[model samples]
Target chain A: MNIHLTDQPIDVAAVLASVQDEGAGAVNTFIGTVRNQSTGRRVVRLDYEAYDAMAVHQMRRVAEQAREKWPMLCQVAIIHRKGRLEIGDVAVVVAVSTPHRADSFAACQYIIDTIKQVVPIWKKEEYEDGSVWVAAHP
Target chain B: MKLKIALFGIAKEIVGSSQLELEAPERQSVADLIAQLRAQYPALNALTSFAVAVNSEYAPEDYCLRENDEIALIPPVSGG
Candidate 1:
């Protein structure tokens, strides 16, 4: 399990490569991007802020849960960002590897959805006019 | 007996402080501290939608608590 918070975009290929193992037959990844529009408004940029300690901790918890659910899950990698982001910027990444495809897919989705619902990271939506903070990933 | 607890996010901002020491029965869970915090910090009362974690791990509503644990009060998420 790996969880990190950096201002830099996560290297999806690197994450996938690191988790590759001969024993695993399947790998699934979920990448979240900055959407161009929201609530009928065109977004100019986005700023993500996190209680880093708690956010990383929450990501680890998600990995642990996936491991418990499927012991065959070989590895799990979770990366998120904190700071200003523009459209197409990578906001979050989740990857899971297992011996079978089904378990990997199920576990990957569970991890992403759970992190959104439970984690405490907040975002400031920067529009052309102004910005506001609100609960997202519900 | 009582224990020391730490707050974060909007809770810390509302309290105008980072941590607080409150009196509670021994072996109280995270929920207990939250109750006291809500009573003492009126600003936090308005934010009923919150989350908690103990020692950086997400704590469910029924999660048990301990003394000196770094309990975090997390506001709603605004992430991707």
Candidate 2:
């Protein structure tokens, strides 16, 4: 399991390499990027803030859940970015490897969906006129 | 009895102080603490979805509070 919160771009290929070993026949990845539009407004940039300790803890918990549900899983990597991000920036990256393709896909989806619901993170949208805090979740 | 509360994110800024000392009688339920919190900090009125955490873990509305416990008002959750 690998979890990272950093300004540096997430190394998707490198992370895949870590988990793609002999027993892992399939790997799945999900990349979340900063969207150019939101709620009918043009987004210029986004600033993400997270409680570091809680965020890391949440990631570890997600990984633990995946391992528990799927014993065949080989590895899981989840990385999130902090600080200001442009419209095209990569906000989150999730990759999972399992013995088969179906498990990889299911586990990847579960991790991403769970993260959206439980992670404690806030996003501020910077538009042309001003900025508005999204007021909820990672 | 007075209980201390800690605010985070927007709530923290609106309350002016990261922590506030609220006056509530002993053995008050978590929901009671919220009522006093909303009354004391009118700005919190805008926040409709806050979870009460006693000693850093989630507690239901019926959960009771003690003076020794540390209560946090968690803002709406966001993650992904």
lDDT leader = 2
**Model 1 per-residue lDDT tens digits across residues B33-80:** 677777777766666477677778768777777766777777677565
Q: State each model's TM-score restricted to chain B.
A: 0.76, 0.85
What's model 2's lDDT at A46?
87
Candidate 2 lDDT over A1-138, as tens digits, reads: 889888777777787776776888898999999999888989999887776666677788888998899888898999988788998888898999888999999999999998876666667789998877675433
Q: Name the 10 consecutive residues with the lowest summed lDDT in model 2 chain A.
A: A129-138
Q: What are the per-model C-alpha RMSD values against the true structure?
A: 3.3, 3.0
Instruction: Report model 2's chain A TM-score.
Output: 0.93
Docking class of 1: acceptable
- lDDT score, candidate 2: 0.79
lDDT of 2 at A27: 89
Q: Clashing residue pairs in candidate 1, if any?
A: none
User: Highest TM-score, which number?
Assistant: 2
TM-score of each prediction: 0.79, 0.83
